[model samples]
Target: MKLGKEYQQLTPEDFTINPEQPEDFQQAIAQLVTQSTSWHGVVQCCGHDFTGEETSVSETGYGSTLLLVQALVKAELSPLPRLWLVTQGAQPLDSHPVMSGVVKSSLGMVKTISSEHPGLRCVAIDLDPQQTVEEQARMLMAEIWSESREDEVAFRQGIRYVAQLIDSHWTQSTLTVQQYQFLQQIKTASISERQNILRDYLQSEIVQVLGMNHEQVDLQKPLNDMGVDSLMALELRSRIKTHLEVELKISKFVEGVSISDLATEVNEQLEQIETNQENNLDNEEQINSAEGNNIDWLEGEL
Candidate 1:
């Protein structure tokens, strides 16, 4: 029997949350942890004048894996800096003498970096060679300042809302029509549901729009590689709005580093957009009502 068919027979209870086997249900989570390391190397290399580094570590996915596991744990548990080395996967490593010393050394390194250094920040832009550093910085500042005080408050609230969504599995819960549409617009599937609506749209609409090939792209790659240049980033913004019929901020690119990360970021922005729109409508109605009341009072005085 095939592994796919056999794996389908497993139950959620078979993979309960525990310290012993954290990577049980969320393999994607583990994969993200690994990919984050590769992404870190790539980003670091691209940022500096270096050809990528070479190390004989079997765990090429170490950097991303460490960053994500730490982030998720911090987000879920303590907000402090710490690290964990998981010991279960398709290729398991025994807790033997050869690996034990290395694992301890790695943990020590994680603790040092997590405590001393601020985490890396990933950013995306839609600019060409024509834009100077000063020009780009000015543009970013203007965009940041465009948000009124009220919008800024709503934006922070939107981040909390997104944290909640991730806390809950991406289930189709109760949502407004627009919220539902936004979810549908960026929906992507794992290996199982690759042919489903969300994944299909991601491949054709998003992947094609960004000029990425199916073969060259894997689910784990950084989303920026999908021709996510400045123009394509704006194109993604426009397409998302057209498909979902909701406006979202471009700053979400700075927050989400990978394709999965981008999905989370977009969802958060969509929630913020919805909330802001609702608040604006309510304020407009209140203003109109107050104006009518003032006109009625003047008429009575006359």
Candidate 2:
């Protein structure tokens, strides 16, 4: 361990998991967890996308990442490590609009994982791809060690920026009256209706962002194949989270997932949210009823 602090290196080989079963990934990481009784932090530098022959980013960024996160979740360590996922050009900065590769997808997974495992203190940092390796390394190392809680961060021209989804105001006065009414009723709409709305909203955003005509977007076609780069995918994911209250998976946006598939995923999230809400209400009612019975018993004793 460098700096005399307990740190652990989880290699690429250590990130292995069976697609059919998760036991190996779990056991491997559990052993790593035992190596440190309590860890100060853990850093994972997911490598950059291929430039030449293969020309694909999913295997490195998507599936393997899924495995690694699952392993960490399964390990069930007592004191979870503060995880920093470092990548080159993983996020979108205003100055640099070329959002490409699995790094961006990693950010999506980070958001989901952070919400599900708040103790992990997970964040994804995107380096300025144009900068020299030494410069990027210095900045990345500094940010990783710093006590910053910024979730998704990116560097542009030596400045750091964190991702935030500002409430969109541009939708006003742009759509027909019926569409406006639909927006007002979206939350109360049926599951199928909500899915349709999400699909329509995505289509509109894609058309506007990509400079494509209304007829050009194909819902069944993969966003990646339609030239949906990281910047576009990030924006789309942000808008979906802000408007529809669903964090669309990286696969839905990056790894050749189609618009129809995204809508279905959104619908499933909505259903899960509804189920959770009902369960909470039932629990509250039961608690209240028990409290009332206890009060009656105390009065009878008096």
Candidate 3:
């Protein structure tokens, strides 16, 4: 198969790969692993020849790449700062059965690895064959160095598409005028009423973040089990702190904690803070009243 102009343009420094012999392939990988030791971040481009049909050669190639990545991860003395997997397929990579199978399988593996090794900051990039090698290389390099937290990126027909998952929770410390008025109206409401309000707020936030409907979210189910990763958890925490002015530990948002439990905790903290504020204001007023009485008595004597 003829190499694409983009692939031809890539230099040895750009990427290192050897498919001729097992020892050479291992040696090239060792060099990469050694180079990665000093580098803060490493981006591995798993280039494959998509020309072949679904055959033993393609299967072995894909398996070899997977094992190499596993070896890199295992060889690292410390967790890698970031790991990016770049896979290229001809235009409509998903349409070709052989290429699609490999890409999909790779995607699943990367996603699982990302979940298991959160510190690796794993991401997958799918390159379009329609675009020039130059375009693909440029985009891939930018993504590797960019401080984007996006988990999935695709370059289709020279356009870049990024998909980021985040909670839609409002992160404003101060409520809007309308929200403030609504809260004021319900200040004298029962604890259950307040809890219900918070619960609804949290439910909406989770639904928006998870891209699901309110009915789909089980209040009692753990958020992690529902595919809420660390990034999502952090976003939720930020939203809660900003909206409710309640500081929650990161641990509270992890796997074992349910949304219902989180909402209840937030409500309790909000109530406690409000109660303390009210108590302080009452004490201040009492002190002022006492001082006024003393001043009035002194003035009469004078």
Candidate 4:
């Protein structure tokens, strides 16, 4: 399967980056969305293993980042943020930055750490699955030019958008009812309450939705440390939306936050929801009891 074709078929927007110029690629991505200001940088991890003969890049255990960036350019997500990836022994660094403006993963690092001296095991990888390369660039321009608040919000939206995009490309599954309800709580809850609600529901839903043991998705730990990447976040976000029937911004509230915090937010919102429901039920019961004693219908018929 070609990454570009697959991405084009599965995704709603065009995301293409400069095959030759990483900087151009970043600028392109920022343009497609809103609320984004500037990109920190971009790094290509070791995922860019693509062959000219194939329609999409092969997921052949290495170098898929290039294909991903290519897709971004094609899709035209503007304000392309910077790119980052590990340095392959053969990578052309003079042309590409050690890390692009946006965050990135280093597959090379993963390979290196696998050896006896596994020191640099923990690293972050960011991918743009949404707008094209041009769009990403536009997003950057808008961000750089916009005010601070505007830039922050835009950046939040951009990452969230990218998370959703990646999720769409990677997974295809229907959501369960519980996932739906949990999503609703996440959307309306206040920041404090949302954290509580997320914690309560995430614990229950991780197994049901992600098919992992409770121990695997420990909410007490940080997401990056838990081995959760942008793609996983995207998958989680997608499932939550599918089940919850609402679109939650993965980047705005979910990104860079610890699983513990998320779980806490979820729990708080859930508690509030339960409280509200109970209050409504109590009011209904009181009204019913009062009406029962009145016997107005019987009196009128007689």
- Per-residue lDDT of candidate 4, residues 77-190 (tens digit): 333343333322122122332332121224343334323111111222222324465745544433333211110111222332111234322221243223323444455567
Q: Clash pairs of candidate 3?
A: 6-133
Highest lDDT among the candidates is held by which one? 2
Runs with alpha carbons beyond 4 Å of true place in candidate 4: 1-221, 224-231, 240-249, 252-254, 296-302
User: Number of backbone collisions per candidate, in order?
Assistant: 7, 1, 1, 137
lDDT of 2 by residue, 1-302 (tens): 11112223457224444432445546656776676657666776665664524433433544545556677756766456677777776554544444444544676778877766666668887778889998787677666644444777777665566766674111122323233234445656777788788788888888888899979999999989999998888888877676555687555688988878887887788778767876864665466557656877999999
User: TM-score, each model?
Assistant: 0.28, 0.44, 0.41, 0.26
Better of 2 and 3 by TM-score: 2
Which 10 consecutive residues of model 4 have the lowest summed lDDT?
147-156
Model 2: residue 100 alpha-carbon error in angstroms: 6.1
Q: Ranking under TM-score, best-scoring first?
A: 2, 3, 1, 4
lDDT string, candidate 3, 230-295, tens digits? 888888888776565679888887858888888789878877877787686466546655765687
lDDT of candidate 1 over 177-233, digit per residue (tens)? 244334443332332342344334544566677565677655545656544666666
RMSD of each: 25.2, 20.7, 24.5, 24.6
Q: How far off is residue 188 in model 3, in Å?
A: 53
Clashes of 2: 1
In order, what lDDT does every prediction score? 0.37, 0.65, 0.61, 0.42
lDDT of 1 at 130: 35
TM-score of 1: 0.28
Lowest lDDT block of 10, candidate 3: 1-10
Positional deviation of residue 43's Cα in model 4 after best superposition, in angstroms: 62
